[model samples]
Target: MDNQVRVAVADDHPVIRMGIEATLDDISFIDRIGSVADSTQLVALLDTQPCDVLVTDYAMPGGQYGDGMELIAFVRHRYPDLRIVVLTSMEKLALIRGLMTHGINAVLSKADDMSHLRAAIQATRTGRRYYSPRIANLLKALPATGSARLSQRESEVIALYVGGDSINTIAEKLQRSKQTISTQKVTAMRKLGIETDADLFKYAIELGLTRKKPLSD
Candidate 1:
């Protein structure tokens, strides 16, 4: 049809991808262009396939294009006209605000009903932002005061630190001084209101900042 909205989906999990694709397929005005399992595939598909809307998972790591806020920023810049809807299970206000900052058109919680996907896609198509019920409520209920934006370096430092990397090792890996790494960690923790390493690890795990298992103390 002339007015059909071409949509592509990207999610690392097969089940979630399948469910989203199925939901997109069922939408009357949506044309399911492609569905990919990672950021790399999504970028490649976007390069070749003309799409109007992109529905992507926020935590698809291990892709050369990266994921989370990084991937969203890249896609928003690369395809300025394409509307984006982010699907995530994260409940962190900081992460949600970060996605919005990067210009995603909608934020939909994975826990929301699959039917909400259609609404999100439609809203974005019309140049409006959409948040699923749970996510909207979260935004309303949560205080926005401590949602300090994490710099790219600080985000990287937190991910590495929470993934069980020592300050010394992270410094060596990132080619920075150990003191600098320690400072970054401390600053990131303070911004995040994380009081201890255990809480930092929990925060990382909850936000899907890193895939590595938490280290035992």
Candidate 2:
């Protein structure tokens, strides 16, 4: 294949990894370099391997290098030229915004069809931003939580929480005190008119807050 786009996939689930590989198999221009099960291995591969695009799951547990935002940040810093396509189930606008702010090339939801992945990969390989249609709709539909919009810090707090981080974890990651993190969470929830954690999750989903989880095996 001439000018083939080499792609590496990082996903914990064997099925999802294989599915991505299989999807790219039909595209002659995309060469599947291989797949890794965690962010640690993905980073190692990125150091030793040459790839034009990376398709990685948002959350892969059991890696010392961490997952989600941390790993994304690491990759962006170390491999500035590599195009990143994040595969996630989370619909959180704040989370997506955060990832975009960090310069991720593309984001595709697991719920969307494989065609979306194909488009994302193609667009990203060419240095374009690609967001799944579902994601785009969610972004367009985002509304103010209450009488006032959420502050950047408040949105960051809720985004981390929705991504499965605990209050302490969020505080540690954000370099804020636990009380401050908790207060931000509460404030964000109140602004969204959410009284309970469960309701908060639902509200987040309603507002396109995507839950970051490993693809099902």
| Top of the candidates by TM-score | 1
Lowest lDDT block of 10, candidate 2: 208-217
lDDT of each: 0.83, 0.80
Q: For each candidate, what TM-score against the reference?
A: 0.68, 0.67
Q: Estimate, for each residue in 1-217, the C-alpha lDDT of model 1 and write its tens digit.
A: 3999999999999999999988888889988999998888998999999999999998999898888876877888899999999999987665665576567759999998988998999899998989999889877764453456778998899878777788998999999999999998888776665668876665565445665555666
The TM-score between candidate 2 and the true structure equals 0.67
Candidate 2's C-alpha runs over 4 A off are: 144-217
The global Cα lDDT (0 to 1) of model 2 is 0.80
The collision pairs in model 2 are 90-210, 90-211, 91-208, 91-209, 91-210, 92-209, 92-210
lDDT of 2 by residue, 1-217 (tens): 3788889999999998888888888888888888999977888888898998999998787786778887887888889899999999887665676577678768998888877878898888888989998777766665555435679999999888877788988989999999999998888775655668876775555344656452342
TM-score between candidate 1 and the true structure: 0.68
